[model samples]
Target: MEVKDKIVIVTGAGSGIGRATAIHFAKFGATVVVSDINTESAQKVVDEIISNKGKAIVNKCNVAKFEEVENLVNSTVNEFGKLDVIVNNAGIGPNLLRTHESRLKDWDAVIAVNQTGVFYCMKVALQQFLEQGYGNIVNIASLAGLKASPNNISYSASKFAVVGMTKSAAMEYATKNIRVNAVCPGYTESALLNQLIGAKPEMDAILKSVIPMKRYGKAEEIADAVVWLASDNTRFITGQTITLDGGTSL
Candidate 1:
């Protein structure tokens, strides 16, 4: 759908891909709701959007909490009059740990945020879409969801679940005009990847070497793809994971 003047919601928009996606949507004339766990960060993004002559609002939400997600959707509709699109981009990655070394706490935390959080967002957004007869969802999954990441088993598992959720939800709502899709970014330059590289400095070179492009993907590049997918031009597309990795998976 055309994004101009559409009411959009972007979660985990305090930093990284979420932030970029929120700003990009606003730049395209969408009235964006900048939802993030951090209040200050969310407000900052809202301020940035307003400074650039774009429309935005801040909503502090911890996606792991179902109640908070429900409130987010309710409040968005209350303030904007309707909901058009939602980007379930809020996710967390546990530190790199092998499957055997992984702790239950770490695994649960990752799943709660990355997988279950997306489910909650999708569920609430779909409800509103059903009420309004249309909506769009772009979930930020990961390249790890497609291929095994040896050191980060928890994150991979959770993302894989997100990919599945996206497909299942899309199929169920395809005839209802509610489109659900996913964006799988590989080793993009973001706080998450920087943290991973910080822990294993040697892996930085290894990561770049594996990518045929020999470079890390940019947050804006991924953001561009997200906004495009959220547009009306892709009404025929749903339940697909658009991988943004630089040929690393190949």
Candidate 2:
């Protein structure tokens, strides 16, 4: 992965997979913008990167808002001189309920953050890329996006939209040198997973049992794939979804 000196942005970078990806990008010598809704957590990740002799900055952004997303990209370019890559990783899960039983508010919230958020980021970044003539975008989707997620209608719908957007944008911008791709992770070990397991302890085992590997994925493992996709190593690959599910999607 040759990402040295690349200007990269990782949304939802305060913790979990986004945090790991930000750290990894910094370690690879990329100037990373750790963007998150949580300013404190984003600052902590920035501090950790700086302490490790890596360049990083904190940008508090709620991806749900287009204006905020615009500012995030504009500010990064204003500070860094150019935009190179953006990892659209900020997303929210929906309440555990069937489609008919789910609240409309939950669906709207999930779509706002998970689907529309990605669109805003991509739109703003693509504008910059069109001007610069090159860019990379890696969207963090989910196994639910590829397969059906029963009782998780909102999450599934949003992630599926992410996958669709990635492919569509890739095709639309291929001639412009803008590459777009997605990573679909399954049951990754993260704060989100912890919350789910906390709510239903038995889910941990049940989730693992369906996978051939019979285990969860680490945040760092998913980060590695994201970085590779963002790096020059995968320059020729676009509009693709890399599944990191420990065989759950098999």
Candidate 3:
């Protein structure tokens, strides 16, 4: 997928799937805006991209905040003149607990960042896209969004919202040259997964055993799907969720 000269924005580009996706976009010749709440981590990614002769810039943003999300999209356009695509990769996972045992604070936290954050970013970006007459969005949802996530109610709910919003927006602007899609990664080797493994060491084996591939997916693997969905190669594909679960969901 050639995205040369395209201007792209990747939220939570400081780590994991977000980091990988930002790097991939830069490698493919997109002028990437590496956005993260952690400016330090974001700068490191920008430095690496610059060192490799790739184009990128750091834009600190807390996606949970509407003002920051607005500024993220606005600042990118202000700096780059236009935005071609946005990868809504910034999201937080929840503590593993049954619904009744789960903390309300945890649910709120997850919804704020994962669900509302995606909506905030999409809302601002859609405005810009409408003005420009064309744009693309690739939301990094989770396989949990597509199926039952037993103990992780909040995360599942937030991601499900992302999937719904993606589809709704895709159909709403289908004829307007705006494409919206989501990537649902299952048991990926991400910081979120590491946290889970840290809490329950046996989860690593348990998770892998359920997947047909019998392995945890690499962040780069998920990034590849994000890149493809954002590229012109999938120009006609929208309102879709590409699940990368190694058949675990089946």
TM-scores for all predictions: 0.98, 0.99, 0.99
lDDT scores of the candidates, listed in order: 0.93, 0.95, 0.95
Model 1 alpha-carbon drift over 4 Å, by segment? none
Candidates, ranked, lDDT:
2, 3, 1
Better of 1 and 3 by TM-score: 3
Overall local distance difference test of candidate 1: 0.93
**Model 2, which residues run further than 4 Å from truth?**
none
Looking at model 3, the pairs that clash are none
* Candidate number that wins on lDDT, 1 or 2: 2
TM-score of 1: 0.98
Model 3 agreement with the true structure over 48-157: per-residue lDDT tens digits: 99999999999999999999999999999999899999999999987999999999899999999999999999999999999999999999999999999899999999
